[model samples]
Target: MPVLLYVLAVAVFAQGTSEFVLAGLVPGISADLGVSLAEAGYLTSGFAVGMVVGAPLTAAVGRRLAPRWTLSACLAVFVLAHVSGALTDSFGVLLGTRFVAALANAGFLAVALSTATRVVPAGRRARALSVLLGGTTLALIAGVPAGALLGELWGWRSALWAIAGLSAAALVAVGRLTPPRTSTDHPGSARPRLDLRAELRTLRSPDLLRHLGLGALVNGATFCAFTYLAVTVTDGAGLVPSLVPLVLALFGLGAFAGVSVAGRLADTRGRLLLDVAGPALLAGWIAWAALADSPAAVWVLAPVQGALSFAVGSTLIARSMAAAQGAPTMGGAFSTVALNLGALLGPVLGGASLGTAGTAGPLIVSTALVAVAVGLRLVTARRRSGAPAR
Candidate 1:
């Protein structure tokens, strides 16, 4: 584990917190901005959209720049977006800030992942990637909870202010830690030309595309349950509102544990994980839906579900990067887009089930989504082995 990976994780912590903490501040924002809660919720959706758009665009524009500089620029922009968001009086301006901040977040993550793998030994690439992703799971456990508390105590703007300050500190750390130049940045000294045409061609691989789609499905299923987890915890389990954070904490802890364990195995046992995780998740989600009425079961299963979700999610991403090894940086963008696309869709499908299905709706949806992923994986595997597709 390189020290630089931790530094990047810290930066990711600051940015990732921004992605989730908005839910806690929705009430404050809606009241302050004179908008409906539905409207304020769009802030999160806007951020997701921005991330999907920004990853590839930012990667292409910064392809020539050293990653140290790219990461720094991203954190700087992230800081600026938060500062702007904190000071804004208009809801429209705030929405725009969310979009801008997500762009920064997307670019930072894509570059940070690529850089982490490059700096580490090849054998540890998966572990290195997980360490970077740990920051995200950590954000869920500690950072978002803290930010929501800040919003509760001081107001929504205060949460943004805290995020901005935290992000600024991370910016300084990134600037200090990452290498200022790679060989690619060197002028006229055996700089391998990365032909855009060649890279684009690599994206067309069926295997790579399958990995991307599978990654999306895994993420979609995770988000399907996760987005509405609070509802399930509160309304279904009959837990007090205050306990929601504790449940979320359990989920995050499980996610962190999952990522750590999966990271270590992703390089060596990735195939095994891929083969096993889907069925595990399918069972987990089905059990979750069946047991939604049991408070004890819900409590016990939160961590289990979290662990399964991140393990499978991380494995799929590792596989995607492995497949996209031809253009590793662009691979980062593709992975980000796939994962965020899932993030965006998961909530929509889950939300749809809420009206008629109640608390179990999202869980059932989650089960179905992962089932599709499992089927796809099996089909793709058979095809690769020269078996006819079912």
Candidate 2:
């Protein structure tokens, strides 16, 4: 793998830590700001909203710039946003900073994934992409736990400061390590006939839509359960407050392992079977978690859930890149945007269920969504086979 993969992975790790650290520190943030837990939840929702809007917006703005420069600039912005988040005392300012940070983050990941594919040999593309995305797992394994510990010791603000420092390190790494620009017209070259109409035309392909729907379903179910993991572990499973981050770290380790294995599987076998199986497995695991009240059970299940939930990232992403035909960048961006959309909706659905039905509701609802998704995948497969030949 190219050394740049490690560089981009570092940037991604920083971004992922910033994104998820808030969950572990939610109680601290709520207490510090004198806000309710529900309101503090905006931190997660705000970031998702930013990614949803920012992914395409930033991609469009950076279209003319070199991918390397675009990535570096985004990391710099991420550093600034984390600093701003660390310094802000007001809830509104902290939320706004997170949003800004997410904008940069969205652009960084989208461009980095596309560029990773471009820099590697065709056969090694999936592995390169997996290594790049594995940074998120690393963040969960290391950064989030560290941030949570920092929050527990120094305060949530201090945790944000640590994240800022990581972002700064990533900015420097990307600046020094990202390869030089090879084409000003590279984006155009990838999609010479690109336009809103042309993009929409591609969407009309039922096969492509099926694959995208699978991606969304898998992600949505995963995020729904994941968003409230801290709450579930603390309240539902009766774990102590201090141990949540440690469990989360364990979950992250599982995700890292899952992504590694899934990447090779996707490259060797097709993604469709993995797509179908992953969500099914996740649903079962989450259901088991909901019923098991033992802390030991929770500990064992956390990693199992994480592994199953994240197993699809590389496969789904590579599938989308392939489905995009020649427009890898646009395809990469769209796939990410779809994933963000899932993140956005997942929490809302989970939160609503939690409100209406209490602790077990979210997992039950998540399981239902995954089952529906599996059925959709079957229907989608049948439809693809029955469609008139291109």
Best by the lDDT measure = 1
Q: What tens digits encode model 2's per-residue C-alpha lDDT throughout 1-390?
A: 878898888888888888888887889989989899989988988998888887777776776677778898888888888888888789999899989989999988888877887777666667777898799899889988788789989999898788778778877877787767644233234424355445546766655666667677767877777777877778888889888777877878888987787777666665554755565665665665467456776777778777876776567777676676545445667777888887877777988988876766667666776676667765665676674211
Model 1, position 185: C-alpha lDDT score: 24
Report how far residue 264 has shifted in candidate 1, in Å: 0.6
Error of 2 at 346 (Å): 1.2
Give the alpha-carbon lDDT of every model: 0.86, 0.76
Each prediction's TM-score versus the true structure: 0.96, 0.89
- Model 2: clashing residue pairs? none
Give the Å shift of residue 293 in candidate 1.
1.2
Residue by residue across 1-390, what tens digits does model 1's lDDT show? 878899899888888899999988999999998999999999999999999998888877887788888889989999999999999899999999999999989988888877877777777888989999999999999999999989989999998998899888888888888887664322335546476566667789887888889889889988888889989988988888889899999999999999998999989988887777778988999898998877897788999989989998987888777777677567788888899999998999999999989989999899999999989878776777775321
